[model samples]
Target chain A: MKLEGKRLIWQEYQKEIADDHYFYARSCIRQTFFPGAEAVFVKIMKDELGKDIHDEQHHTSCTGIGYHADVVPFDTTMTVIARQFALMTEAGYENYAASCVTSFGLYTEVLETWHHFPEKEAQVREFLYKATGREFNKPKNLAHASDIVYKFRHQIAAKAKYKLIDKNTGEPLKVVEHIGCHYSKMFPHKGIGGAEYPYVLSGMIEAWGGEVIDYPERRHCCGFGFRQYIVQANRGFSLSCSKKKFDSMEPYQPDMIITNCPGCPMFLDRWQYALSEMEGKTYGKNNNGIPVFTYEEVAGMIMGYDPWKIGLQLHQVSAEPLLDKIGIPYDPLSKFKGKNGEDLGIPETPNYLKFYAD
Target chain B: MQKHIVVIGAGPAGLESSANLSNLGFRVTLVEKEEVTGGHLNKWHALFPSLASGKHTIEAIVKGLNPGIKIQTATKVTGIEAVNDYFTVSGHNGWQEKADAVVLTTGFQLFDSHRKEEYGYGIYENVITSADLEKQFASGKEFVNRQGKKPERVGFVHCVGSRDEKVNNLHCSKVCCITAVKQAIEVKQMIPEADVFCFYMDLRMFGRHYEELYKQAQEKYNIQFIRGRLSESTEDKDGNIIVKVEDTLLGKPLRIKVGLLVLMAGMEFPPATKALTNMLGLKNVSDGFIQPLDEVLHSNLTEIPGVFIAGTCSGPKSVSDTMADARSAALAVAEYLK
Candidate 1:
């Protein structure tokens, strides 16, 4: 399928993305659920590309989950984001790179609010200064890490050891790219290709030699509806939401599902597993379940980084077939085994995100 | 000297305006880009609410065309410049005309449903446009499924390409909501077994007798209305379209699988209209339709003294409204020639 409205031109996709010296703010959900993926992102920025990405210890969370979960008030969340800006200014960086889609969306929301109501911005500044004698400078450009990776996809591809093509058939793998709702929904112009056909992940899929699949549910939210999934009684709403996406994409038989959001990847993978146990149906080839990955994980693999170190084994659905399909050599015994091939017995995980050593 | 007026399109507006202006004893030249000239009205299977044949309506309008009016077919207008006393219009194929006044009735092109990629118009097999549905109805295919079986459910999604910030179009396509209501009734009449649903952000029943049709759709046809914009559409393994929408009325997210999904694509500024606008230096409102000199007082007059706009090229309108507006534009031209 065609990429639709989004062409390969970088500027037409999104306004601007900074290349260096960025103040990186981690996502609460991204760090907790996919910790290794975040670490891999930092590794790629520092070791692989030698870019300066400051993930300072004192940089507070954007509290996007707390805000969306309705646990935190608007003032509290704005203050926390303001505090993060203070941390960035203290570190002398003007570019803000968010690790999570929710945080990126929140950042955009607050920025757009400030644009619409400069008085609200002044209030935020006063609130920040009054809360902690901290003076801050607004970031010049705000970008999601996924957006950065998308901007640099071709640069990384030129150094990649392999394309995202199925090795057996020698054809580009059919990849379905799911953009997080927050990345583009709130303010489309701030997003890649203005939300209609977001080019963020799709551009990377194209750049890395993968055939992008277009399904009707391509733009639907992962249904993480943070509050919906957080409350035990409302989990059905979230599950049914992803069920719609899975049911839609199943007909196309994509080789893998890739998302730019942490919660989306976590939910998409978990829900597919949940759907199988609940409905007695599976979507992946050979009944292994389709592999879902963050753009960071896939980018790392294509960069020829060690998959185990990047925590590919931590996924609920095994990425084993994907690794094998791409002909990336992974020792099955070492999957549960440690780096030194020692038995570090894994702790018991939940039934939904069931892990290795179970 | 004969009072001459040049009309830019030979669609209903041009035909009606040419006929009306010629009746007032003014010489008229009707220019059309296509080899034949019913414009968009020529393609429709039937009109809304009444299910009357659009062909018959267009044929009558063409029959009413004054024999004194000259018809220029398959001609492309490149520019129109207002000379000292009259307007000089130039076109390809060495065609030229001069008139005391000009009327732009370029009409409009239906919004490209493909632009809203989430709806899966071109990508999904089961999804078709409202215009396509009319043609399907015209062909006497009451129920259309690839398997030739009656569909279990049919969905009509309003505003596929209108009033959406995502596509850079913010004006409501005036007739779509009522059109959806009318089409839903037709679907129910065709397949009595099928459940019909209309998903819309808001239903605008502004036209006369339109609200009655909507009431009939609800009371008589038993068509369901969901008050929310359909977020996206996806297909199941069996080629059934699964639509996801937030039922704002009930404050719940809903998904339904339907065998046929109709996207009510809206109207857009046609290239022909834009070409005319640029060539004649006509000003367009923020929504991109040619702006009238005064939206209320001088709805037919353009900023360029004697240039007038008519029909859907001015904005979204129903056929009846367009015909009324075209006649008013004819009067404005007639008044200008005086």
Candidate 2:
């Protein structure tokens, strides 16, 4: 049997795996914005991996963003975290996966703090026990979705049926990956596969025959400068963060930019259009900007799964040219293959990328 | 000819003033020294009182802006002179603008935490500024030290830069007390096992929500708020930080060891402001805030005609106050220009 992308990732990075059961703790960002990534992950776990994944709707948002903003009190955030952990423990799962990097970072921080501060932990635990009527400790594994994907890289690679051969060059493509802050900077030590330069996303990109480009602002924050977004009321802050990446990437000109976290992807993708408006410059003649893909979407695409099935069509930034560069033109006018190989036509172009060249 | 209004500082105050003036049918030009426009708020993850994320505040004001206002970022105002009734401002880029009115919204800069050597901010890896914590929080990380270890105990040193007679900064920074309280509570919330302590000279719960927030940190979060200033901090080889200070509340000198130490550095005007004040002939108060003829009556109006001041450039202020000042300055400039 040929090596699949997910399998390749696993072979390179998997430390331990109890794959039968997974506790899927959904992210607030995922539910609010990147629902497609959630749907795709669920589908992958259920259909392909044949794993029993638990996603409790009762689990409220991590509220990390709000808590960090200093808007929501610490006690309120603790209640939410405790309730979510209780829900997971009640479901008979010790392992949990976060869709957003921020959630993972917060969960880990809260848990470590709770474990270290026994008196406070007891108070919180007792309070949660009274409120939810459930005994709970911190989760054993607060894994990001990329963690599992990277763990099972080989399996994912072997599953690829459709190869993304470049039409112009007749070779595998070149790519760049932007790891979100929630994943890398927040906890640099426990990152996926613990590679100094974790090859999780880049490894998969290479498996699909694309080279990962390291740009200047690779480690720079997206300057979503969330506070700046509101208090100062200037669009320039956002533009500057996006421009750093754009200007850096302009010289290298990678075919596409891949990211793991939803927030990073949203800013990078949406800001491209905003940048165009600010600079009065178009990226390409057809104005097709850099396409963004999540680690799962990229892995699934390499696995030869239909684009729509893996939520590729839902991206605000078009991945159409990316598909073309890989020797497969994702015909927007034409239908895409569904799970059962049924036809689902290409999605409507987002307003950000409404104008596209032929 | 369109009456051009030039606004100094691209921070919240500057942006707000420009936007407000532009809305009233004035051609407004806003300048910022940095490449970005949000000011210090951009670096902060959350603010006290409502603990609102900086995003919501930034977006709300930004969304309410007049798009017609021309925003010039990465440009500094080098010289400003009143030519008759109009003000001419020059920039390093050789860019010059003649404004019918000016609003000096130049916000406060963070006091160099390192300058207070007793705090050990830059010297110790574990010793970080409140600004550093804000960035971590904004980046979505929980309150863990640079060592990747969850701190068992954390100490917050208040009034590190503010209210220091030695630094010639005698005025009480209105926000530091509440800010220290808020951070202590957050640390406790993140790590219930972690003991959190705030060493401060006085707990200034002056604002509307300020008192409530301080109480919540004490009553609800169980954070220990000590009314004492930190004397000095030292890091052991273990990297665990030890703080020596008089617990003024207890009136006894005590040593507390903690895994992390955060400095609540106060706000100040940058040195560049002195040059701007001299060149423009704008009167500055003893404490360096731009002085209006009557602060209460003409808070935004400067001594010179056609020039106004807003935000911390005038005096130390909270975010909410600075924003209000920004708008008031805008109205004053707009009314004058009209």
- DockQ, every prediction: 0.28, 0.01
Task: Assess candidate 2 and give its TM-score to the true structure.
Answer: 0.49
Writing each residue's lDDT as its tens digit, candidate 1 over A125-225 gives 89988989887788999999988888788888988887899898999999989988888878777888767577788889989989888776777778797
Q: How many steric overlaps are in each model, in order?
A: 0, 49
Best by lDDT: 1
Best by DockQ: 1
Judge candidate 1 at residue A259 and give its lDDT: 91
Q: What digit string (tens of lDDT, one per residue) describes model 2 on residues B147-256? A: 88999999888887789986788877788888888778777878988888988777888888888888888888878877777766755546677777887767897878
Model 2 lDDT per residue over A1-358, tens place: 1124224333444444445578887777655454467777777777777778887778888887887667888777887888888888889898888887778777777776777887767787878878878777577777788777766666666666655457677765657777766664554545653322445577667666677665434555665645644446665777687776677666666777777776777777777767666565544336778777777777667665666556565565667777766645354543345556676655545454444322
Q: Give the share of true interchain contacts found in each model.
A: 0.31, 0.00
Residue B45 lDDT in model 1?
A: 73
- Window of ten residues with lowest summed lDDT in model 2 chain A: A1-10
Scored against the true structure, residue A283 in model 2 reaches a CA lDDT of: 49
Put down candidate 1 lDDT per residue, B70-101, tens digits, no spaces: 99999989889889988999888889999899
